[model samples]
Target: MEFPCDDNRISIVDLPEDCLLAIFRKLESDTDRNSFGLTCHRWLQIQNFGRQSLQFYCSLTIPNLSPLSQVVPNINSFHLYRLLSRFQQLSSLSLSGCTELPDSGLNPLQYFGSNLQSLYLDCCFGITDNGLSLVATGCPSLTSISLYRCSITDVGLEILVKACKALKDVNLSYCSLISDIGIRALSRECHEIQAVKISFCRNIFGIGFKGCSQALTFLEADSCKLDPEGILGVVSGGGLEYLNVSALSSCIRGDGLAAIGAGFAMRLRILNLRMCRSVSDESVVAIAKGCPALHEWNLALCHEVKLSGWEAVGFNCHNLEILHVNRCRNLCDRGFQALRDGCNRLSVLYMHRCCCVTVTAIELFKYIRGNVKIKEEELMYIGPKWPFFR
Candidate 1:
């Protein structure tokens, strides 16, 4: 922005930093602040940093204007667009709890949706397949979207991917209606998607991710009722850096789980299998061989894994930094010794109610490696007594 006079001229860009900051302080509204930032990249950077000292938004105060959620039902598309058009630089929109906002409420997005890159509709129960279609049609530039607990099925998912090819991160957790069919659509169509969180979506298995093999890195799909084949499908991509398939119980077969360490282990850094009761030493040893680069491992409540497994972890996974083996019933002092001896880089160790591990072993490890942070509790109170091989 430039101010011109007959003899002299000055630009907003030429103003001193202090003058710019002083001028920005007088503007209170988010829209005004947003407009101030859009003058140039320098002003945008300054506005973002300066907001910490002089801020805007309703917060706990009275709504300066009608809250967007309250006006959803009554506001017409034209009025809504006219109101939202004030903030020409709006990039992130969160309507996480507008439970009653029907599909028509999304019509306003079409008018000013190009500026939006992230949309969060978590727990919006009224957003059916039709509503998501509106979102896909309106917000073509959306790179990240969360549909947590939304009532959308495969049709809605198919519609979304067909329109928004730039989607990189999506959250479908607890979206009970979605299944592998919907996921396959996402996998095949959205080539740029890197993170997919599908926790508690029981119908989906790892097989749907077969198409996201090239770019897939982070996957968190805990308690999805995965079977043997499903477990195998999870590691099939092998490019994953962080993987969590925790709480997978009775349905998964031993051989299927063991194969994760044997064949599919790529450059995995973090692996979480907490409460997976069927994880045996075979799987553990195979994991040690397959994923020697593991940095953080959580085997909490894994009663089936014994000393051999611990020994393998110590000998092979030298890069191991943090470990959680709380309630591992059979892991004794020798098992602890293997970890103490081999995992020199071990920094954080969590062991509570590991009854078979005597206090002497813990004390000795502390004496040897004083830097290793340990989290433990007295086991005598609740640990199994001589009645069951204490």
Candidate 2:
């Protein structure tokens, strides 16, 4: 059968560009997207220029993508503001781009400043004090802001606390320019600050938490330069539920951890002291006795905790479900009994790379606690994958 030329008839490629984009976004599979792109050069162009299927960003999906930024280095504020005007009630936005979204790029945030509740900008070194000021002034209602590896100093942080008093969560990880002054400023004004992450912020001595101590629930100060008093100050509030002080091996000791166990362990749930070489049996015993409600604990690389600590954990932390003692040089078969006897509800155990714990001991432990799941997962360099994080 011979078909007509059909030159005059409209084809699938002739669908309006916006309609095509909408259809492309609806596609959930990579194969389908690839097939769609192969239809014609026009669709390919659209797919190539835009961010990967924003799927009509329900707000905060890193819209106006990095590819476009790479293509159009200086995407002026006019076009960005105009595009954002569509999402009138938008309350969240994630503008992550490596060097593409400089301080000038954040200028468009002024439009969504009032209703914006959350903002995430990571590795945006271009964002300085001035750009922060712009955001702070516009988004007074902002409750959460994550600025990872930014170049903001205490001056900009002060500017932020002065404006956003209702802030509840802030991540200043790797922001080296900020010091205790910024923390003190936040403590003074940001009374609602509930969660704070100062990871690698070596300048923070931990004195500033006193202001929001009553409201603080989550604090991730891993690898920070906090001494014993600083650790005490952070947990003294007793309202904390999750705390991560990993890699503070040289700065933290048993006394600091014991303080948390003795006084603030009532509400404490998840504690990560991985790589704290100084944490010994006494600290572990104290924590286990006090924080009976502890759900998950990570003691990886803590070589100092001995059989006593494991025994104490089993005796007290009946609710302990997940335990990680990976690479514990001294963890042996005898210690496994303490856990097997006490933690009846223990569901998961991670003993990867533990040289002292024999295979027969593991088999015996498994035979007894058949309901518990055991896995030997070596530590990977992956970023922290916890609930409070991010």
Candidate 3:
């Protein structure tokens, strides 16, 4: 028995060193570095230089660890902490899905303190205020932090706000533990803070975001327990560029939206109220009158709004690019006519399950040579069937 081998072979030495490095950088995320390290001795040498900044969303599981153990030492908390002490140039970190890490104290801080600028602990249930305090105190360069769905209290938040005064963006979405007191603390202390996301914080009962020290650019809280006063607090803040309050769909009818429109008339850009079922043309007109600078708006499934509201949006929001009005049963051909005529700049429009639109409306699309000459390059309609009925 004999084995045949190809005589032709490419020389790794001939390739430019920089070219080899580019390949190594791209392979950094391939766990255990097997893809690049096993390629050749030259490839293994390229890995030693280390890339600029390595970021990982999931765990950086060690290869030698068993399937049951993502880290060394058989899933021990202390051992896992030791494993993370190796990353040197990690500036940004994302741990969106890790729920096993211990959150009682700052056990993870020692590994993260060196050069971290941004940290995302979204949905990491293992962490508590103590861990957060460690982050605020240890990571001096920290500018942005997200604690989405993390269990946190006013104490933890107060410490973070007080310690990380340089912080700019903080996302506390779905942290039900927070209330008006925590928000007031954030507003009073975090002066340099620019953008704060506080969606689904149901405990924020009556207090408004009136005393916030910094100007807010984005605010979102859908399907959380909040009254008219809470809604008014955010609208009165006035520096909002993006706003979403679908949770208060009924409370923020025409009047609330009108107030938001009037307050954020200059800076408002994106608005999303997918299930704001009670919002009618009254609020739509108010928004059209007030928020002229809107670029993208989503009123998907808003039942009460009539066709006239679409006309107001078409006529006023010239810079509008994306619109999602799916399931607006009351919408008619006249409203679409306004949308086609006034919303000439639209690039993406979603009109799924809209029963009022006729087959004639489908022809109106630029592709069908209707009056509205929207470029074929744009436009996206959902639902099946020709002419898109209902």
Candidate 4:
């Protein structure tokens, strides 16, 4: 049987090498590119050279990663650290959920030490302080490190800060073992540290930001054991732009909020006080009075915040765009009206589970110039299910 072929047809191979590469670059998706590359040897070579980031999901066997590394030699962003020597230009690596990646597997990363900058080992349960110590020693150029739910402790953190002086952003969220010692070490050593997230670290207390980097702009210590002193230490740092002190119900009070508002008046933009039950109108008033640059405020589950506080925020924070007052049971129609009257720039308002808030109250937000979007939950029924039966 004769195969159908047009005599005048110009095949893709007939095109110039550069033109072929340009065509491959426009493929958009990696899968499509890979498929196109597999069509011919030249396309494959072009794809390999042009490839910048590569992700291998559960495909890499811990014992032997040579085959995969040999497959993608020019990858800069990698998931597996097994044969990093092959990829000298590697800059970002994420070993998230790589349960098989043990301490010994991290040895390969030493080859790309100087080149690697962003490292994420989130939820890598096997990675302990020892493994991280190796990481610190190897990846000295690391600027961003996220170890969410990792087994790393203050010891590992100390080692990391001691070695990685260029470190700017670090996330130790859910690192339960981390405490004041580790945080203090970071503050003392890493002067370039801009953002530190220690949320859900229950053991952390008294993380004094007094001596820390003045470059520190973002701090997230939600659900931590930070007291008033700790809170003051953070706000007093004078460079904070984004602060999330949510769920510090026991330690944070009106005074602490006021201090934050006053200290970070011009810089403060995003403030999250979720589940901070102790915070009342007094604290909100203080924030409104001080933080003129406030844009996003999350007072979710803060039961104490009433109409007065909402009004204060709306009236004071002119730049406020997103406001989350979810579960603020005290918020009513008057509060919504106040918010509408004060916050002209308000665009997104979340009032989920706000039992006292009526539809009539929410209607007032309709007149907002930019068209305000209000997210609310079903009206909560506080009375007995069967009044007659009761």
Candidate 5:
């Protein structure tokens, strides 16, 4: 037996500095980043020199100032402030799901003025209009902003929207403070806006969107207190390309969704009607007949729909690519078979918690991406398995 010392030898000295920096930047977990930072002097040097985007879940146990910390420690604050100053290259920032951080901790974006672009503060309990103002004023060039479940008021949104003129994509879903006034301002000021998601923001019912000429590519105002009048108003505005209003939690079952199906069906590309228990199979059929351009649809958690609803969607929407029917116990294998039979361009399918659907549904739906998954009955209903995210 000959010992092959040459074959076992590995060297980091030959690797380029840029290549090493790229490796450090690719690290997803902050713990891993900190570990790599401790490996060697060479690694530390590369980490400091490299420009990297940081996404923190905000826990006090994470060594540095957690995103949950309402009052950022002086040392960590100084460190983050210094990092942003030295590396003006930081662009993407997501502080979502950290319920602990208070308003003070989130206001530091003013220190990062003009550097941040993509910001996701979804489900952050500490966030309010004041914290939002800091980001909008500091990051004037911000294009993408998602603030779902934040306690952002209309006043805060108004100020922030005025500051962010170049905004193209925004998601204010479940921001209950927003009213028709905020929507009206967005319609008036944000002319370049392409996508606006205000799901369950039930304030924009009777209020009108004045600027309808700019051609908005997407609008998701699902489950707001909408009627045929509100639906007609949005469609008449002349900018919608994608519309989602599956569940209104308030008035989803009435003629609002039907008005959407009949009025704006020509321009829509995607629609989400998840958990709209009020919506019956008749509404789905009407929408399918009206919205000829609709391609992607989500009917998750809707118990009212039956085979007739699935048949209409399958028959009319030939370009459908993505479909979500999670928790819809009414849809059986027959509906899955119909989806498989008609939808040729389908790529993503989510049928989580649909008891009527078995593993057979997953096998039938073609073109599913690697990201999509199907949970078993016991696991899906009882609790999540390991490596699965809720």
Candidate 6:
């Protein structure tokens, strides 16, 4: 037999292990990684070792825990404690929508708390205050947690903030039971908190945000009963980057918006004022002048703002990229033209339900290289479907 010693005949297996690992790292999607892993045993081992985050979504079809236990031996009896104990290297764990998971399932987490950095328990209705208390006490090193639509109340939140002082981000959105008490506790205890989402938590008011940590950057309180006082309290923190006070028609007015424009001038990047009927041209102009860093802005259904205000925004906020003027009956072609002229960086424009915006002005927007989603009715008259229109 003749031995082939040509360089062109070198197989992929001949490459160094570190080189193969580096190649695998370049694969972006899980499907690509999995396919690469099946090529060889060494690749499979590297892929398995690279997998550090685990997520489990139990279905009613597999109601019995026996089959799941066979697949993931550590998750026997739906006990999270046993699972965490086995996967000591896990940095992130998500048990979202696990309604069957009980309080006892979290008891063993204390042993592996230091290893955990992020946890998601969204819509886990079966886990009550007692279960949440166990999580707070156990996960001392946790930096982020999401309890969206959970049954956790003020008592559970108090326990969590007290224990997880290192927490940076939290999401209590749609948690109906969370009130001012819980918000106050979180603000006072978690001084390092950066982002919070409390939208649809009806009981939360402006007072809940008072004296919040200066480190606070993002806040979402849409569809809540937040008043001007609450809005003032949030802006007073000064480090805010993104703020959503949408649908607070009864509370937010010219004064509140002016306060936001003044306080968040340097840091504010995104602002959502959807359906804030009280917002007028004066306040809009004030916001444009004050917030130079403002990029993405939503003024949908704010009918009080006219062409003059938008013109000012275009001139002042050069960095503005996204603008939503849906249902703003007062805005006309002249205003949009001014806006287009001033805001050279405008990328996404929503002009649905604005009857005053003529087809000529819409055609003018076609020249700009960005997305411009108009109402279906408006598209019919425009003839050719542009690639940018959606």
- The reply for model 6, stretches above 4 Å from the true place, is 1-51, 59-78, 253-255, 363-390
TM-score against truth, every candidate:
0.79, 0.78, 0.72, 0.77, 0.63, 0.76
Q: Clashing residue pairs, candidate 1?
A: none
Locate the minimum summed-lDDT window of 10 residues in model 4.
381-390
lDDT of 4 by residue, 1-390 (tens): 976689867887889878987887788886897698687777776765555443444323233565545332222224444346444556676666565566666776666566778887776777899888888878999888888888888899899899998888888899998888898888888989888888898887655565566788888787887876677678766777788887884766665666676545468878888888888788788888888888888888878888788789777889988888888888888887788887878887776777797766665566544488876752222111311110
Across 1-390, the per-residue lDDT of candidate 2 in tens digits comes to 977678877877788888887887788898887677676788876565333211222222445666444332343466557655544445666664444556776676776567788877766668899889989878889888888888999999999989999988899999999888899898788877888889999988776665355788888888887876676777777788888888874667665677668766578878888888888899898889888778888888989988998899889998888888899887888888888888977898877888998889888888999998887884532223544334
Candidate 5, 250-311: lDDT as tens digits = 64454446666665547776676766777888788888788777666777787878898887
Could you report the Cα RMSD, in angstroms, for every candidate shown? Answer: 8.9, 7.6, 9.0, 10.1, 8.9, 7.7
Count of backbone collisions in candidate 4: 0
The residue-by-residue lDDT of candidate 3 on 1-390, one tens digit each, is 955565555566567879877766666465855566666776666654443344333443234555565532223346435534644556666656566655643455555565777787776777788887778777777778888888889889888878777777888888989888888888777676667777677777536477454367766666655555665566665676776666453445554455556544467778777777777787788888788778878778788788778889888888887788778888887887788788666777766777897867857655532433332232232212211000
> Considering summed lDDT, which 10 consecutive residues are worst modelled in model 1?
381-390
Per-residue CA lDDT of candidate 6, range 208-297, in tens? 778788898888787887876777677777788787878874666665667676645468888888888878788888889888888788
From the highest TM-score down, the ranking of the candidates is: 1, 2, 4, 6, 3, 5
**Cα distance off (Å), candidate 1, residue 136:** 1.4
Residue pairs that clash (backbone atoms under 3 angstroms), model 5: 58-67, 68-101, 223-248, 246-273
Give the distance in Å from residue 238's predicted Cα in candidate 5 to where it truly belongs. Answer: 5.3
Weakest 10 consecutive residues, lDDT, candidate 6?
380-389
Judging by lDDT, tell me the better candidate of 1 and 3.
1
Cα error of candidate 3 at position 233, Å: 3.1
Q: TM-score for candidate 3, please give it.
A: 0.72
lDDT by residue for model 1 (99-191), tens: 665677778777767767788777677789998898888889888888988899999999999899888888898998898889889988888
Query: What lDDT score is found at residue 388 in candidate 2?
Result: 36
Model 3 lowest lDDT segment of ten: 381-390
